[model samples]
Target: MPRAKRKRASSENSTEPAAKAGDKEVEKTVTSGAITPKNKSAQKTGEPEEYAHWLLKSEPESRMDKGIDMKFGIEDLKSQPNQTACWDGVRNYQARNFMRKMKTGQKAFFYHSNCKEPGVAGVVEIVKEAYTDHTQFDPKNPHYDSSSSRDNPRWFMVDVQFVRMLNRFIPLAELKQIHLKHKASGGPLKNMALFTRARLSVQPLTQEEFDFIVSLEDVKA
Candidate 1:
C-alpha cells in the first residue's frame, strides 16, 4: 500500500487548487503511465501548444509489480533502448493542448505522482512533437472516447526521451516550504502551474522556475 503522506495548506498567496501540489485530497487524475502510450508516428502532428517548460506526471509502478521507478518513471525513460517513448493516454483537453505546444528537442520534467514519493524525479526531451492519441480510437481500450474521429483528433500525445535525474529528489514537501518562503516576494514558483493546478497531468514551468528547482538538487548534492 502507498504510504499516507503529510499534508499542508497551499501557499497563503493562493486559494484555488488548480495548480501546485500539497492538499488533503489524494490528487487523482487518469494520468497514470501504467498503460502504454500509443505511438502514432504516421498521424499528423499539431502546431505548438504555446508553452515552454512542462512537468508531466506518471505512476512509476503502473505497468508492473514492485516497480523500481523505471518502467514508466525516469528509470524507464533512461533505460529505454534509446531512452525514448511516446506520452499518451491523456483525456483532459487542457493537458492535450499542452502537449500540442511541445516542439522537437524541448525538455520537460518527468514527475512521479500518486506514489510513495511525489515530486520532479527527472528530465526528458521532446523527441517528437504532438500527434493524435490513437488510444482514443480503440473501442476496447480504457481511454477510448466515443466522440473522437480520424478527421478530428480530440486528444494528442508527444514522444519524450530521457535526459537525466535531478542530483536529488525534490519532494513536494520541500516545494511547499519553498512556496511559503517566497510567497511574500512572488518568487519563480509564485505562479507555477504545479501548485495551482495540482491535479493537472501536464503543466507549464518557467525556465527560471525550472532552474530554481534544479538548483535545489545541486545545492543538496
Candidate 2:
C-alpha cells in the first residue's frame, strides 16, 4: 500500500467549563442542518439503540497551542475527572457538522494522530450531544474565533466519557493496508472517511466499519 502523507491531526483545545459528572443534557432540535439524522426517536427511547459511529483524531504527543499543551490521547481522557471531557476546538465547518449529528450513548473510536504510531487506541461514548463550544468565544484561547458569537455560535462540541482501550493498538499503517484490500475486494471499508476525507478531524464510520475494526483487536498481527 502506498503511504499517503499524514497531515497533522486537527488541533483541539478544550478550556470550557466542565459539566457536572453524569449530567446528560436534553437534546435540542436542530432547526437547520443538512446532516441531521433521520431517526431521532432512538435518542428518546430508553432502550438499547443503534448509534452512528465516528472516528475522532487528536495529537497524543506534546504540541503547544497558545502556550497550552494540546496533547490529548486516550490516557489523557482516562485521567480526566469523571473520565469525561468536552470535545472542542473543531473549527472546520464539516467536522462541526459531524459533531452536531452525534447523540448521547453513541460510541466513537479515540484515534491518536500526529504521533509515531497513530491509530485507534480506545473508545469513547458521547455523554452529551453537541453544544456551543465556549472556547470559540474566549479571546485568549488558541481556537478563539472573533467571527463566532454567543448568540449564534459558529462552533460546537460534544462531551464524551472514556470507554475501554482497544485490546491492542491498531496502527494506521495496518488500517491503510486493510483499506486497500477492502477497496480491491469491494468490502465495507472501501469508502471509509479516514481515507476518503483524511484531512477532516472528525470522520463518520459505518457500523460495519466500526465493528470490523474493533474485531481486529482479537486477531493476531
Cα TM-score per model: 0.72, 0.79
- Tens-digit lDDT track for model 1 on 11-128? 1111222333222233243232211225232122321224467888865654332221223567756665676777766666556656777778888888876566678898988888
What lDDT score belongs to each candidate, Candidate 1 first? 0.63, 0.73
In model 1, what lDDT does residue 209 have? 83
lDDT of 2 by residue, 1-221 (tens): 11111112355323111222112231142222534245465345321233389998877888776777777778888877788888887766667767888989999999888777778999999899898887888887777789777998877888888899999999888988999999999887787877876766787888988999999999987
TM-score of 1: 0.72
Superposed Cα deviation of residue 38, candidate 1 (Å): 35
